[model samples]
Target: MTHPELVIRKAVWKGEEVDLLVADGKILDVIPSSDTMYEGAEVVAAKGLLLMPSMTDVHTHLREPGFEYKEDIASGLKAAVHGGFSNIMCMANTDPVNDNAVVTDEMLRKAKAAYPEGGPRLFPIGALTKGLEGKELAPMHEMAEAGCAAFSNDGLPVKNSELFRRAMEYGSDTGKPIIDHCEDPYLAPAVGVNEGEVSSVLGLAGQPDVAEAAQVARDLLMAEYLDMHIHLAHISCRKSVDLIAWAKKRGVKVTAETCPHYLLLTEDALNGYSSDTKVNPPLRTADDVDALLAGIKDGTIDMFATDHAPHAAHEKEVEFMHAPCGISGLDSALSLTWSLVASGKITFDDFIRMWTTAPCETFDLPLNSFKKGDPADFFLFDPSEEWVLDATTMHSKGKNTPFRGQTLKGRVISHFLSGKKIV
Candidate 1:
């Protein structure tokens, strides 16, 4: 079937109105809107909408193969597109755990079936430890061959330093970075909140910043010794940022990412004992938030990831201490990040680079630019659109979000991937 030429008219590109012509699954041209003439093409009037390359998330949890109640490949991808993301890398923390080539192949097959004609491509991260048990190393070589984008033991950190080193060394050979969920279980066993005044007032067990910083410190040293690429996932504490900055100065092959919650919200969000605020590497103090912002400014933090963990509503409705540590983020990542941009904390270009360019560079994925011959992957965003985040309106099955009733500015109006409109 020959697809009609897709023409987006009057879209704002770099502060000027432009027309985008997409055909044959590529961007044919980008010309001044006034100079373009529409003929028999499919027209989309995008007046007053901002046009840019869609974003990518390097850390996400699309619970498939074991935990479909929370999220699946199809639902997760739908949520990603709704948030203006064109590519995502899912963590390997499923029921059986994605630890080998078999699981990796199965995920790729399912992803293809979910988006058959190339919509927001899904990349699976194979587990570094078998079953994420932190004992035996997973089949990295075979999984890599089967199309694993990276290796990570995300939900559970590998506590054994020797085992972790071996995994890092092996991962380096695959040319993919070893992403670690930096945490010391011994230091903060089953804790739900950050160790600080808020935790004390709320009477919840606190997971101190040291829990994450210590592990980050260890991983950085290991990366230095082995000279392998290490990417830290969802860093939340100030000390952790300090450690990563110190590592980069020493020329360690390390890159770190911070989630939107860590940058925008703090442990104070848990003031009312809201389980929705409970997240692994629990939210830290305002001081930590400030440090994280500084990290982004100084280039210590490489990218912004949603860490889009989703859980069932029933699971999060119970007592705060027993509730699972996560919140659905795919639907809110862009708006929340836009809040930062609007506040002048980061420039619009910085936000775009972090979400688009930085992630591609970190994962070695194909960079998307709305250039001629480039894949037609972009989104139309309305920065002034204001709306409340209602869980029922979301595409993801898991609606356990802390921002459920919050009003957010900016929203994705339309998205095209591979010259096809998926949202």
Candidate 2:
């Protein structure tokens, strides 16, 4: 008999009662649940817990090669594995920016050295424009060769239409999607609050939802015009959803994603005047959240992403207006999304599809097939487990989440990569 390295007994995999055997850091087989056991193998009894494919995040900020103070590749990958993410793509908004091959190489090197014992894999997203300034194009082909999965100008939207069009044209040849932060800089309000009753109540300048929708419309047209792929990042409001739905019907080569914050929280969160609630494409109204949910159900949203933007405490501790925009959400995004499933708002299939297959297919990242020779990257999750969100609970160095102090359900019990438990 072939000797297996490890066996997880009776874990529910895709709703099937199965026994998983791993060998040589790859899945050897998944047999029906049985008492027959493999001798001389490390065994884990995972009855009643979920054995699901680890998640893939298309958007995250590792903040290395510059702002390591907020989060470096090591801390970010650590947080990712703890969050059950086996594959994560980091955005390019560093001090020097990941616009060229050198910065891309630096990000790749840092990721390579992180979690050598088994951790989440990181893919760098090179800058769409030089310095993320929107004025000059970055070296797309060079960065692509340096291991950039995609290119993005996250946190800095390119306002010049012609320049953005030229960047997209250049990006098409890289064989990597150009992910866009869809918010019109000129129309976006300086304040982080969303335009709504809560912002009026707080007396804060509110960013209109049109700021996102207008840019979405622009990018959709650009995708249709250029006949190229452009992925929209962190879409927040209803109008954008409607536009995407229309574009999809018309066969525009566009894909979009919404963060957990937009699906779960509304602008009402800013009533406390906490800087933690502040995020770009700030949380919108219940009506907007409803639209986003509907978009998810109908397949217009394309996929789910955390937009796990982390910020230093000092960077977010100032007055709400002065504080930088972001939420340290890698820790809470999964559980909050699971809450929707637990509440019957979305199905288990929808959850798994959006979290795993959808994003991986969208970005061309590898997805765990749980088949023989497939890398053993998966997790055991306790749906019954409930815990509170706090500084200690988060693995990321930045603890700027608005969900802090809230009790959350569905915790990851064990995270395994390459047939070994890492968290």
lDDT tens readout by residue for model 2, 1-423: 357889999999778999999998888999898988677899999999999888999999988878889999899988888899999999999979898999889887878788656578888999988999988999999999999999998888898999899989988887889999887788754467888788888888888999889989999999999999889998899999999999999999988898899988888888779999999989899999999899889999878899888999999989898998888878887899999999987788888888888888888887877878888889999988999999889999999998899999999999888888988
Give me the overall lDDT of model 2: 0.88
The candidate that wins on TM-score is 2
lDDT of 2 at 33: 88
lDDT of 1 by residue, 362-392 (tens): 8977666776787788999999999988876
The alpha-carbon RMSD values of the candidates against the true structure, listed in the order shown, are 2.1, 1.5
Shift in Å, residue 239, candidate 1: 0.9
Positional deviation of residue 47's Cα in model 2 after best superposition, in angstroms: 1.1
Q: Extract clashing residue pairs from model 1.
A: none
Q: Kindly report which residue pairs in candidate 2 clash with one another.
A: none
Minimal lDDT window, size 10, model 1: 34-43
